[model samples]
Target: MKALFIGGTGIISSAITRQLSETDGCELYLLNRGNRNESLPANVKVLQADINDESQVAKLIEDLSFDVVADFIAFRPEQLERDYRLFHGKTKQFIFISSASAYQKPLSDYRVTESTPLANPYWEYSRNKIACEEYLIKQYREQGFPITIVRPSHTYDERSIPLGVHGSKGSWQVARRMLANKPVIIHGDGTSLWTMTHNRDFAKGFIGLMGNIHAIGEAVQITSDETVTWNQIYAAIADALGVKLQAVHVSSEFLAACSKEDYTGGLIGDKANSVVFDNAKLKRLVPDFVASTRFDQGVKQTVAHVLAHPECQTEDPEFDIWCDKVIDALQGAIASVKGR
Candidate 1:
């Protein structure tokens, strides 16, 4: 099978790229601007063109076609439009990496499946993803576009630890605080259920859908069955870092009001709410798919990788200061209430 991945070097797609590159009789091509070409496997071919530049990409891949083309970076419907223009009838299968967050916000039910209504008013990112899914589904229905929608929920890799609440830079600041014994903020009492899947595990199920005729025109969510609370997630990170969890619980609304970043979207729209994915559809489609990495094991590996690689530990002093400020204000509020 021949597969082409657009923007392949990312947290989720990177694992898929690695999986396909190693599979027997599989030919893989990565279409990107050649930024992290060195990180890819040796067998994977490189198409050195920006996916946004339609003409340049068209010229580059004029004579080539693939069994699969997966786009990881396309966030908006316009991007999907560009993909349709570029790869219409060019590939056997087109996989859109949609987010599970595109599922209904403040869901009527805690369990999320592909059938979950697409609605997220708080985050434009999720709304755009929802739109992209709708467009691709329409294309599949109207034009016989061989499209497969795979929604991933909070998938993590070795590069970064997954967390519900964190600053713009990344989750490194929170991990740093854990190591320093400083209080880290967890939104909403830290008991909300969240599922975190390792990218490697996500790769297994995604690969199953590559040339799968059954998967075309279907939307499937692939996530781990393991559900852990936000508290357990932070505790795992702190355990991995060999530090005690000094966590300060704060309201999601307060955190949104305090931060300059789009916490309203990142938190309320997506991570703040409890989500437990029903991977029954994914299992039915990919009979062999299983998410083997537990949260503790995955996060432990992630924390160790970040500790070993100083480059990954890029400190965010501004976020750190902001965390301290939030913690201090919360403490002051407690003091004032006690005085009253």
Candidate 2:
């Protein structure tokens, strides 16, 4: 299989890159700015060009055609428009990495399938993804663009731990608080269920879709069937850190009001809601694909990787301070009510 991945070295795409590179007959090519090409496999060809600059990217891949082209960085519909121009007839399959968050906000049902409605008014990111999906589907239906939409939900790798409530920098701060024995904030009583897929496991399902005739013209969401509460997710982090869980539950509304971050969208619109994805569609398309990583096991590997790698241990003091403030204010409110 000859495949090209745009913006390949990310939390999700990096794993795919690695897996495909090691495959017996896979010819993998990566197109990006080439800043994060340090640890990629030597067999992989690197095309160093910014995808935003269409002319530059066009010239770079003028003579090269791929069996599959997956775009990991396209967030807007205009970007999809550019991709259509660049790879209209050049590839047999075009996979757009959409988000499962594109599923309806406050979903009518907790279970999600490929047929789930694409509507997310609460998050501009999800809404934009929906638009991108719409554009690609139109292209496929009207002009046979050969597009396959793959939606990933809360995928994590060894580089970063996944969490419900965290600041802009990422979930490292939340893990750091766990290590330091500081209280970590969990939104919406921590009982709302969520699913986190290990990126390595996500890679298996994604690779199955590449150059797959069945996946073309279809939107499939690839996620683990395992669903755990936000509390259980955080507890796994604490267990990985070898510390007692010091969790402070806060209302999603209050957290959104207190923080400058997009808690309203990231929390209420997405994470605060209980979501269990039905992977029957993925299974029918890719019979061998199964997400084998449990939350506890994956979180342990992630926490261990973060601890061993200094680069992943980025300290977000500002977010840490903000967490303290949120926890303190909640405590004060509770105390005041008790005194009254």
lDDT of 1: 0.92
Question: How accurate locally is residue 107 in candidate 2, as Cα lDDT from 0 to 100?
Answer: 95
RMSD of 2: 0.9
Listed per model in order, the count of residue pairs whose N, CA or C atoms clash below 3 Å is: 0, 0
| Sliding window of 10 residues with minimal summed lDDT for model 2 | 164-173
Per-candidate local distance difference test: 0.92, 0.92
TM-score (C-alpha, index-matched) for candidate 1: 0.99
Which residue pairs in model 1 clash with each other? Answer: none
**Candidate 2: regions farther than 4 A off:** none
Error of 2 at 208 (Å): 0.5
